[model samples]
Target: MQNLENGFIIKQVDFKDNDKILTIFTKKGKLSVIAKGAKSGKRANLLDLANYIEFQTIKSKGLDIITTISMRNSFHLSKDKSSLYIFYPLEVISKIDRVDQDESQLFDLLNFTLSNLYKNQDLYISLFNIKTLLYEGLLSDFTNCFVCLKPLEVDIQNISSMMGISHFGCDLREYNVRGYPISIDTVKLLRYIKDLDLKAPHLGFDIKETVLKEILLFSTNLLESSFDIKLLSKNYIL
Candidate 1:
């Protein structure tokens, strides 16, 4: 059997006496595999499924079995309160994208975002990445107007409409083409975060206070209408 390497275990489940049903997100994409006898507290010593992990596996019969599990590195983020910060990305990724899909760039975006969420920096940077990258396209860098190719000025009143984002204009009248009007800073930071590591700088920007807020409102509306983002974040905070 061939071996699969260097993947993170996104999720896991127990079966029968001690088997595990695991959902893994690898660089090769996604998979659901069974690792035999992994449930008991004793056998549980085998793998730690928290943050990011490096792993290798072999296919046996119909399922992939873990050959080895690397060190556990996500302990800081997996704690109770920390996970609340990750809700937005997890919501967007699981909802809009199909399972077993290869979105290497998107996946890297998420990995970086996860690393940054706990850094006492702006969480909106993560949200911005989610917006222009996830729903928008490979060509959509959002730093400039798609039509005029000029830097955008955020007129917050016009920001609520999709026409503001997709077509790219300072005013709603500027576009005969219909599209969403994303925020100026939202576009800038979205482009910024895509390439930069998710190590959020000590930015003075506030998501709720900036035009970015309106952009997120628009992005949220679009995702909800197009995909079931709410359905994925069903695990709510208390």
Candidate 2:
């Protein structure tokens, strides 16, 4: 039997002379599909990464076979900067396993980010990274210290390379954890983002470039340290 679904083309690889292997992130989760005769034609365009697509697939023991596919939304990322925002999330999610268990939350988060990336690039970039960590259960609680287990006020905090977060003044000689210090402003912004509704209209806030860099760096380091995998797209942002 054939199944019909809509998904975003997160990753694609040329298979042979005329086919392509596509990694589509759907509401049901990520699917590996083989698009026969899709390497160079109308179908090839629709199969491009970052494009939202609707398609029918015949399930198999191996990768699903795409029988029919069409573009749903390309998101129109006009600027190079905007394109990286699309790439970062796609790259991160594609590498992490078991994200499909979140139901449609992961799919919706990407949809929301792509749909609204143009409105505020800096805001959406930070939100997308934070939301990814949130959905994956990787973010440390913003209201409390990760090491001390005490209520953390707004202040400079240290994010250890060993995957621990703590107040800057917290001792770490015994734990042997070392990390860079982040400002109180960075803490406030992260707490604010942790509380945001990604589906709702987020009024853009003023952010200094330095603070934005700090947020992105922290997120990248957290994911890398927790998963022990480097995020290549991070090089584009910071």
Candidate 3:
């Protein structure tokens, strides 16, 4: 039987002779496929990382075999300063287990985030992280204090590495947690992103360098703790 799917090439490894192994994140989920004679041909450059592709494959014993491929949307990130942001999400998605799970939402989020990276790299990266957490049901409520259940106003801090947020007077040692202080601006930014409509057009907002750095750090911590996967491409963004 032949299977048809549209996805992004998240990873690729050289195979013997003229073959290459690819990890594609499709609407269904992540799939590992072997593309024969793809190393040196018209298909060589077609199956590149971050390239959205529509392809046909045949299931074999271990991995699927790619029979044909057509390019969809190829994002040019070679010289883009936010190249690291592009790579980190791909690496994270590649590590996700391809079990019998629906990944359509993740696929959409990735596509949207990649498309908007050039517009605001830092914002998009933070958006991607926050969305990923929400999609995975790992994100905590940022609107109120986890301990007091009161509306969070100012001087918020990340209590737990995963998604715990608390006010300044909260006992950190009681929770047996420690994290950096998160400014109210960063908190508001995250809340704004969480409620944003990705498909709509809107004016961009300005963010301070300090706030951006704090948000990035908080996002990295959230991802690492929730997924237990280290993003090797993070160095590019840092």
Better of 1 and 3 by TM-score: 3
Q: Which candidate number has the best lDDT?
A: 3
Candidate 3 matches the true fold with a TM-score of 0.89
Model 1 lDDT tens row, 28-49: 5666677777776554754445
Candidate 3 weakest ten by summed lDDT: 154-163
Candidate 2 collision pairs: none
For TM-score, the strongest prediction is 3
lDDT (Cα, 0-100) at 146 in candidate 3: 61
Where does candidate 1 clash, by residue pair? Answer: 162-179, 162-180, 163-179, 164-180, 164-181, 165-180, 165-181, 165-182, 166-180
Give the alpha carbon lDDT tens digit for every residue of 1-238 in model 3: 5866899999999998999999999888888899999888798889878999999998889798999899999876657566666887898888755587888889999999889887767777888888888888877678877666676765444432225566655536446555556777887777777777777835276789887887887887787778888878877776
How far residue 131's Cα lies from its native spot in candidate 3, in Å, is 0.4
TM-score of 1: 0.63
Off by over 4 Å in 2: 79-81, 99-102, 154-164, 169-171, 174-177
Per-model lDDT:
0.53, 0.75, 0.79
Score every model by TM-score: 0.63, 0.88, 0.89
- Give model 3 RMSD, 1 decimal: 2.4
Ten-residue region with minimum lDDT total, candidate 2: 155-164
